[model samples]
Target: MSQDSTVVCVVCGGPAGEPVYASDRECSITSLCEVVPSPTVVRFCQACGHVQTTEMPGIEAYYDTQYKILIESEEEDQLYAMSNGQKVYRLDHQARTLLRKLTPSAAARILDYGSAKGGTLKRLLAERGDLRVHLFDVSAMYLPFWKAFLDEGRWATYRPPAAWRGTFDIITSFFSLEHVARPREMMAEIASLLKPGGTFYGIVPNTFTNIADFVVIDHVNHFSAASLAFLLRASGFGNIDIDEHAHTSAFVVTATAAVQQGTVAGIPRSEIARLGSEVERIAAYWRNFSSCVREFEDGRTGRPAAIYGSGFYGTFIASCLSRPLDIRCFVDQNPFRQGRRLLDRPIIAPEALPEEIGTVYVGLNPVLARAEIAKVACWSGRRLDHFLP
Candidate 1:
């Protein structure tokens, strides 16, 4: 994709500046680590300081037909953390966060927008049985899972029913906004779906906090606090609150519907420059990441290795290596991914790793990758080498 000057910013109507980051490769991997012929080119809007990538061709069809996340099982969930020897899952954390932020009236209507499998709402309902919940998504693939907890009349696919407008007391979106190509239109739709003074609670990845999101090919929008504020205010939402530190690498936001749409103010030029410089720094880091992995592989050629973490980071490490076959398998803590195969290599528990593998490639988030690897007691005393990003 060319970095055309005429490319428009999704957040602000102004033309985007020059490309902040562009991939030389013709194909890129999705967050799920599936390879596709979509080169990434990220740009920032000088008008609003919003950083975003050009939408992938046929993105709508891609999500509707090809995008499947964590669908291996109904119990599948991302591991949030290991707290005192117990696993804290993503869905549990999301439900708790939402409940802590807002208290709904008895039997208040709630909708999960862009809900895939509706896992978070299912967990929420477990805590509050009195709530009336609904689910909506672009695809019908997850209807079977929704059928377990939701009535047939409570869920819709593709477009929501027109009668739903101005009926919901609370609308929630979890990790959905960043994937959208047109966020303004989505925010408008959410605004229209809510009752008067209804709440819109959602979460989006914070690129500043999670550096990995900056290069994820499927994440079209990299929202900053300033840009999120602009999106909500311009979309007829008031009482906006964006919490950056509430969740790791994500911004938890809550906004109330307003009677009149508010004007979006121009971002300061100095603030824009600051955000631009930070984006460039992150882009440079990723540019060097591939080379770092290749150099590591070159020195340890012919040695048996295993990649830890089967998500995007681990798949990226495999993509960088000239000899991917050297990797015997992948190690992950998530039970849902343990039996799966990435690059034809089986994913297994860390304890199930072969004894012959002397080196391990840590393909987790750079922020916590090293610490997580260090916590693996099974690898301790084995004199194994670990290459952490």
Candidate 2:
């Protein structure tokens, strides 16, 4: 990221002159903090309102350096546990939901472009069952983890059975477009990979959630639904639809039959700013309401005897349980998430739990938790008999 070079902003095609700053190295799995020299940071495009870094790391470099750190940071810190984790409804249900808006059979091969460990793909295949599935990510580390979720013969990748080229029905990227140096190129690649009538369904972060921070930090390209629609048309996608999923602060875009790249579409600059403000207002309200409903409790026990799981619902449950229970620890099974703290209380793995003082209030659907725990090899014959009327 030397100052002598110039790069184009992926969002607006503006020139980002030289990378100026770097991000702190982070590992998502262990939440370890290792301070590093700042990498180069870039500026925004005045024409299309795209902000990007001047130097885009190679995909290989991306995986080894910055990308791994970002991911490992989340895993180490149990970030998804801190925030409301994205939940997967069955893939069939997801496909059917989209089919209501998208042509069902028009999508033959489904690829989740930013499929992190294939959660979305699993849900899609879980529903459509017949579609050939492919999961793509810049990092190979997550592939093995995601593969466990796929049926033996159902999923493949870019390094696959050779017949997958240009044969997809739908390609999707959920919460993963803003980081790329050339999103349009990525889309074009996706388009080239798609059959003409094929659709590309994706989501990019807008001004939702902690996007303001993410924009300055993890993300390089942010898009309003309109701006993203314009990006799609430029990539030669038609029948483009922009839908806002407000809570995550993302725009879900569906484009069809992308044969020729179109031009960049954007509203007036003032409108983009106004859209940001409006979304911020809605976001503030959502946060306030969530705060009101989630109060940390003290159940007289020192440990987290209340709340649900260690992810989103767990955070809510624990945050709320803190209001009534003496939640000293948060429980989870993911080794990467154990030993951290949410709202200052320690997060502990189930294996790390000691004999409780008394009482356990479940948050992640009591029935589901009970069933899942029952399936655990160690707890198979155990009775959860701590709570009594």
* Backbone clashes (count) for model 1: 0
Which parts of model 1 have CA positions greater than 4 angstroms off?
A: none
Q: List where candidate 2 sits over 4 angstroms from the true fold.
A: 1-7, 16-42, 53-60, 64-100, 149-162, 212-216, 259-266, 269-345, 348-389
For each candidate in turn, give its C-alpha RMSD to the true structure in angstroms.
1.2, 10.1
Taken over the whole model, the C-alpha lDDT of each candidate is 0.90, 0.53
TM-scores for all predictions: 0.98, 0.58
Residue 187 of model 2 has an lDDT of 80
Question: Mind giving the per-residue lDDT tens digits that candidate 2 earns over 1-389?
Answer: 25554566575565644433333222111112221233424343444544354333344465434554324432232222222334223333334446566655733777777665665566666667776777876666665656666656445543434565678888877767776656877887888878887888876656444333221334556565555766777788888878764223446678886565545556688865665455445435433433444332322434435333555345433433325445556666655656666657666765555565233445343324565444435533434333210
Write the residue-wise lDDT of candidate 1 on 1-389 in tens digits.
Answer: 47579888899888988898887677777877987787888898888889998788888998898898888789999988888778889999999999998999999999999999999999999999999999999999999999999887899999999999999999999999999998999999999999999999999999997888888899999998889998898899989999987778899999998558646778888888899888989989888888999888878736699999998899888888888889999999988788889989999999998989988999988999989998988888786778889
